[model samples]
Target: MTSDAPHSLPDTLFDTAVVAGVGLIGGSLALGLRQRGLVRRLIGYDASYDVLREAEALGVVDEIKTKPGEWLREAELVVLAAPVRVLPALARELAPFLNPAALVTDVGSVKSGIAAELEALGVRNFVPGHPMAGSERGGVTHARAALLENAVWVLTPTDHTPLTALSRVRTLVEELGAAPVVMPPDAHDSLVATVSHLPYLASLALTHLVARDERLSLLAAGGFRDLTRVASGDPRMSRDMVVANRAALREALLRFRRQLERLEADLEDPEELLAAAQEGKRTRDSLPVVKRSLLPQKHDLVVAMPDRPNQIGRVTQALGAAGVNIKDIEVLAIREEGGALRLGLESVEAVARAAELLTQEGFEVRSRR
Candidate 1:
C-alpha cells in the first residue's frame, strides 16, 4: 500500500536505543530496529545473561549493558520490554536515569498499573505501549524481524503523558513498520482483558479439561489443537499477565458468565443456537487482520490441508520461507480426506505470492481475495 516499504529498513531515528529485555517482544524490536538501521547504537539489558548473549550473537543489538540506568542515561529511545509486574518497579528504578527529553516507552500489556507507577514517580516521558503481537514461543531465540510490521502497536498515553512524547513514540513505531494507535490506559486494559487475556485463560482451562481425560487424546483433531495452542505459552508469564490485569479480567469474566448463561439457555432452542453460531462467524470473519512485513492485508488464501501429521507445518514453512506471513488461520469442515485451511496474509501482493507459491508446491490453493 505504501510503495512496498523499502526492502531496506527505515533510516536511523535515534542516536542510542536501549531495550530492557531481550525476550520475544523485546528481542523482536531490537532485531527490527537493527534490520532497518533505525537506531545508531542499540543497547540491551536483560536479566538473563544467556538471552543477552543470544541476542548479541543474533546481531539484534549493538551491545549489551550491565544495567538499565547506564544505557538509560545516554539513550534517545528507551524501551522497557519487561513483564507487567516488573514494569512498575522498572519505572521507579529508571526514573533517575532518564532526562526530560528522552522518549521512554514500554512493551507491557497491562498499562494502567504501569501508568500509575509512572504518574507516582513523575515520569512524564514514559509512554506505555503494548504491541498486540507475539508467537506461542517465547525468548530471544525465536525473535523475528517481521513480527512488528503492520501490527497494531497500542500506546496508552494518559493526561500526564506529554504530547511530544506520544508523537515521538508514534514516529518510532512507524519506523519499525508498525501501526501506532493511541488509547487511554484503562480503556486498553479493559478491552484487551476480554479479547487477549480472557482467551488465554479459556485456552488454559480447555487444555486442562482435555488433559484430564486421557481417552480424548485419541480422537483429538485440528479444532481441539487450535483451541488449546495458546495454553502452551510460558506458564509463569501467562499467569502473570492474567493476574496483573485482574480487575478488568474479573469484569470481563463476569460479562462472559452472562454470555455463557445465555448460551446455556439457548441450548434447548436449536434456532437460537444456530443464530448465535452464525452471528459469531460473522463477527469473527469481520475482525481486522494485522498485516505483517512483506505480506498482504488479511486475505483468506484457502487450501485443502490433508488430515495428517505435519501438514499445516509444511504450508507454514513454505510460506514463511517465501516471506509470506500468516496473520491468522482456520481449519473448517475437517474430514479424513482433508480440511479447508483459510490462511490470512497481509497484502494483495502477499496473497498473490502465497497462492502462487502454494500452487507451485502442489497444494490446491484458491482465494476469494
Candidate 2:
C-alpha cells in the first residue's frame, strides 16, 4: 500500500475474491484486500459455520458460502488460506470449481509437500505461497488488517507453476503491503523448518516441561515466559505443522540439539561457556534484524566489556568521539572483570563506525545486522 514497496500494484482489480478459511491469515488478508479496494467483492468459506458467520459480521467477506463449490467457481482470485495438511486436499477439492484463469495461492508455512500434492493434482493455476507473518494467537478475532504489512510473503513456485499465477499472487501480496519473496518449494520448506518450526517445537517442549514443575511454574518470570510464548499458539495447528514437515524439522532439531549439548557440556567450565556465549553473540549478530516497525529505526550493537567501572562511559564516549549518534546503551552479561554492552545506534553507517571505534579502543564489539 506504501509508495516504497519493491513491487508496484496493478491498476486492474479482482472481480470476485474467495478466501477458503476465515482464520487469522484469511481474515487479515480479506481485511487487507477490502482496505486496498483491490477486490469488487469478497467471499469466504470455512469448515466452522460459527467462524464463517463471525467473519461475515466483521465485514471480512461480502458473502459466506456453506459449500466450496458455491463460491469458488466465481472467484477470479482464490486464496487457500488453510493449514498445510489441509491445503493439498483443498486444492484437490478446488480443482473442478476453479475458473480456468483463476489464480490460487496459500498462506501455508511449509511448501514442498503441498507443492507436490498440487502438482500431482495438475493444478498449474495455483501458486504455493507462505507469508512469514503471524503471532502466537490464532483465529480471526485476533486478526488485524495491518498484520502482513512489511512482512515477507514467500512464493514457492515449482517448475509446473505458471508465470501468470506467480505474478498475480505477488501483486496481491504487494497490495496487502507485504514483500513477496520467490524461491523453490523444497528450499522454502527446509529454511522455514529451522527458523519457524524448530522454534515452535522448542517452545512447546520448554513450556510443557516447566508446567510440570510446580516451583518452576510459580517462579517463571519474563525470560522464561518470553522464550516459550509461541507454545501458547493453537496446539492443533502447531502439531499439524511439525507432523507435516517431519523430515526437515527432524534435521533442524538434530542440529539445534547438538549446539545445546555443547552448551551443556561447557556449563561446568565458565571460560568455555563464556566463549560459546560470545560465539553465539557473533552468529546471532550476523542474522538479519527482524523488522518491528515501519518507522523509528535503531541498529543494535553488542559489545564485550571487561568488568570495570566506567565501561559504559568508555563505549559511549568512543562512539561520540567518532561522531556517531547512539540512541541508547545498556549493560548485559556481567562477568568478573567486564560484561557485554548493548548499544543502539541511529543508522547503519553509525553502526559500522561505532564498531570500528569500539574495537580500536580494545573492546570486542558485535553488530546485529
Candidate 3:
C-alpha cells in the first residue's frame, strides 16, 4: 500500500454507487470512493435521517436517501455497511430496487449467517466481506478515508458466486488501497472469532474485572490502557458482533480457558512458567512484520519526548520539512510528564533520516526493525 492514499484507481469505475448505513465504515468507504473518483455518483442510505443529512453535508456522498427507491436502479455497485445482524434484512429490503447489473457487498463482521441469508433471499450477486480495520470510536463523525488503507479486506465468495462478480469486488478492494484475501464464509467467521471477536470480549472482561476495585482502577497505567483499549468501543456494536458469532466465540473462550488452566496447573513450576512466558514472547516477536500484507515492510522508529504541548506536532513538522512521511503512528506510552511515540516510516532511509532529525532536536529516538 502507498504511504498516503491509493496508488491508482481501478481501470473500470462504477457509474453510480450506493452505501447503506453511512456509519463509520460506510461513510469512510463513501468518502474514499468519491475522493478517488472511483464512482461517478455516490448515494448514501441510512435508517436515521439525521445521519444521511450529515453525510450529505460533509460531502461523503453526492446525495442521501432514507429508503430504497428508483435511485438504487442506477447504482452499479451497492455496499451494505450495516451491523452484522441486520445486514440480511437490509439487503432484502433493498433487493427489489437493485438493478440486475448491480453487485452487492457488505462490511459486516459476521459472514456465514448473512451470506446464507442473502443467498436464501435470492441476492445472487452478493459477496460477503469484512475489512480487518476499525476504531473504537463510532459514527460518521469519526470516519476517515484512510481507515482502510493497508487493511486486509477479506472477501468470502461461495461456490455459487459468479467469477465476474468476485473479480470486480477484488478489484474494488485493491483500488481502495487494501489487500484482498479470499476465503470461505465459515472459515472467515471462525478465524475472526479468535483474532477479532475474542479480543474484544477479553478487553471487556478485563476492564470489568479491574473496575471492581476503585484503587486498582486508579492505579492502572499504560499497559492496562493498551490491553483494554477495545473495551471503550461502542457497546451496542460490540454486543451485536459477539452475539452474531456466539457459537465460534464460545468455542474460542473454551480454548482460552483450557490454556489458562494449563498455566495454572504449572504455577508451582517456575521453569515451566518461564518457558511459557518466553514462548509467548518469541511467538509475538516472530509474527510477520507488515501492515497485513507480506510485502512492503515498514520501518518503525520510537521517539521519547517530554509531555509538553506541541511535542508531537514539532516532531511531525520536522519530518515533514525533511520530506519523510509517516505512514502510521501510535502513542506507545503515556505519562503525566512524558510519553513515547512509535512512528511507521516507509523505508529504512526514511527511518534513519527521521532518527537523525529527531535526535538533533533533542528527542530520544530508537529504530525498531
Q: Name the candidate that leads on lDDT.
A: 3
The candidate scoring highest on TM-score is 3
Tell me the deviation in Å of residue 226 in model 1: 0.9
Poorest lDDT segment (10 consecutive residues) of candidate 2: 1-10
Against the hidden true structure, what lDDT does model 1 obtain? 0.81
lDDT of each: 0.81, 0.81, 0.84
lDDT (Cα, tens digit) per residue for candidate 1, span 161-190: 765567567767878889776789999999
TM-score list, all predictions:
0.75, 0.74, 0.75
In candidate 1, which residue ranges exceed 4 Å CA deviation? 1-10, 69-71, 292-369
Better of 1 and 2 by TM-score: 1
Candidate 1 TM-score over all chains jointly: 0.75
- Could you tell me which residue pairs clash in candidate 1? 295-347, 296-346, 296-347, 297-346, 297-347
Clashing residue pairs in candidate 3, if any?
Answer: none
Error of 3 at 345 (Å): 26
Candidate 2 colliding pairs, count: 4
